[model samples]
Target: MNLYVRSANGYRVASVDEVVSAAKRAINRKYRRGQAFTSPKVVEDYLRVKLSYEDNEKFVALWLDGRHRLIAYEELFQGTIDGTSVYPRVVVQKAIAHNAAAVIVAHPHPSGVAEPSAADENITRRLKQALELVDIRLLDHIVVGKQCVSLAARGLL
Candidate 1:
């Protein structure tokens, strides 16, 4: 639940949120720009670190080059606790701007549920179809909650 982290003064107890933030910073430092993402675990860990539980929904995307190297990471949408709007046009535009050849999209559930709902599947379908027109690959759509569920792994994408 809670852990201790070293600080300038001494070791101090850090909340889950603080630990997640620190992990995210460390990951960002460790995996600099242009590093290829070769493993799905890295994506899962990065998502867990970046999008912890909150009262609202936040949709994020990881932009990757043709070789699966990192280009940029962004939180594109925010909404209430239950649902959020995902615009495929926005995702397409941003991918074009980054010149990304692939993308991994994810969002956290405030209720701490990792199951991909029907809407999630529909959006994934639309996103895949939209991105295909531009020759951009949709790597996966992950649902982050108590645990991560990958739609790609489930053959839903």
Candidate 2:
């Protein structure tokens, strides 16, 4: 389906798929640096652009410095449509390796439901505790699908 998108110039008609693709690319290019990711929306927009179109599940980590600036973003794990195995050890290792003071971890649900599964909660707990040991804070665990659910907002973090 197509929709009308309001651009700075005016409204333009385009397919929903094309609009999403364009938005993703634009967001990536525009917010690569300068913007310190200050809200969950930033992470959500980024993951939506980068991973929302995927067929399989992907777990990505956005490593941040002490000021919450982006250190790096990495797809740490991948799996089939159902679920992916996320190891806290690996996540912590990467945080230490990158000297990340905080992290925002996110994954997409191919099923288009952003609700956290029981497994999602369990892993979030494990990752939080693991990162604590390394002095890196777990800012949030966002589940991205048709919508983005911030576990931190729900006090899941």
Candidate 3:
């Protein structure tokens, strides 16, 4: 489903999914002009808007090719309001399967606090290590809520 603007042509309402799809396309276009994934803020904005309406904890991975072109945005895990169990092995496997050169993983907090818990920190560390073994860089683990927290910026990764 997609939402259309009130244009001179017509009127239409798009579903949240459709809006997100459109947003993704626009964002990709902006970055693909020889700037792929160079701005962390852009990625965070995408994640924030993509997961904004989600009420549950949804773990998403943005898989990127060698040149940092976004290959896919995959929601790999879902859990309750508080937490989700993310398997480093499974994440690594998906990265390998996608032949991704790098990945940015994120999870939204339904409570709207973007703070990274100790578990979040630990998982980031583990995932960094896991991906390192395969030569796939774990670019960042973002905690999304009212805002996005980049563990990498915090030196957590």
lDDT of 3 by residue, 1-157 (tens): 4457665778867666777777777866665433567689888888887776678997889999888878888899999889999999999999999889999999999999999999999999999999999999998999899899999999987
lDDT of candidate 1? 0.90
| Candidates by TM-score, descending order | 1, 2, 3
Candidate 1 residue pairs that clash: none
Ranking by lDDT: 1, 2, 3
How well is each residue in 1-157 modelled by candidate 2, as lDDT tens digits? Answer: 5578787999888776887788877877776643589777777878778777778998999888888888788899999998999999999999999889999999999999999999999999999999999899999999889998989999988
Candidate lDDT scores, in order, read 0.90, 0.88, 0.86
- lDDT of residue 22 for candidate 3: 77
Task: Estimate, for each residue in 1-157, the C-alpha lDDT of model 1 and write its tens digit.
Answer: 5599888999889987787777778989977789888888888888877776567988999999989999988999998998999999999999999999999999998899889999999999999999999999999999999899999999987
TM-score of each: 0.90, 0.85, 0.80
Residue runs of model 2 more than 4 Å from their true location after superposition: 1-21
Flag the better candidate by lDDT, 1 or 2. Answer: 1
Best candidate, TM-score: 1
